[model samples]
Target: MSPGLTADDFDFHLPPELIAQHPPARRSDSRLLDAGSPPALIDRGFRDLPGLLRAGDLVVFNDTRVIPARLWGFKAAGEAGAALGGAVEVLVERVRADNRVWAHVRASKSPKPG
Candidate 1:
């Protein structure tokens, strides 16, 4: 990566089929991307995680304990859940006294105000 590399430089287009609209029925069914080795992408399922750990390993889990302020999903236009066009992801930027939130929405277009 260049020192001057901006976010745009890392931009990418993901095929709609590859986007996950919902969580897997089983948490163990999820796949994990192992990037410990650089320059290579190792795809492994959660079942193989036991092999990746050592005895007496101290583990720290992430924010799944609480509901995320962020979400990712494609716009659903019909009953079949077809990709409306690309994906929509948002992150909570801040909260207001009115109990509303300001979020950073990302997609092909900015969403209209309610």
Candidate 2:
């Protein structure tokens, strides 16, 4: 079996503007950032992925169920009808109460409750 990684060792920070809030022109047009254990990070495009991989390679996936907690809410601009729409992605960390939940939100800008 492989060695286990510590929880703290896997911490990563992603800028809000860099988040995928909007769909790309093409799925393959997305940019890929290499955050692996290399001395320097190499920025590459998705088109290069197919050429880099060879046969007989195995990829492992997490068995955890993914809950689509994607939410589209409008930010409270001056008035009600003039509000702007924004994408907010929330990852449930824990449940505090029946309606209260601890979560991490990623957005292009600060998201406000409608």
Best by lDDT: 1
Candidate 1 root-mean-square deviation in Å: 10.4
* Model 2 global lDDT (CA atoms, 0 to 1): 0.71
* Tens-place lDDT digits, model 2, residues 1-114: 988899987789989987888878998998877655487788888787766567986767588875665545544554556665555667777667687877888878867665
Worst 10 residues of 1 by lDDT: 76-85
1-114: candidate 1 lDDT, tens digit per residue: 658879997699979998889889999999888876777979899888888888997778786455478989765453466646457899987779999999888988765443
Quick one: best TM-score, which candidate? 1
Q: What C-alpha lDDT, on a 0 to 100 scale, does residue 89 get in candidate 1?
A: 93
TM-score of each: 0.45, 0.43
Candidate 2 residue runs with Cα over 4 Å from true position? 1-3, 35-37, 59-114
lDDT at 102, model 2: 78
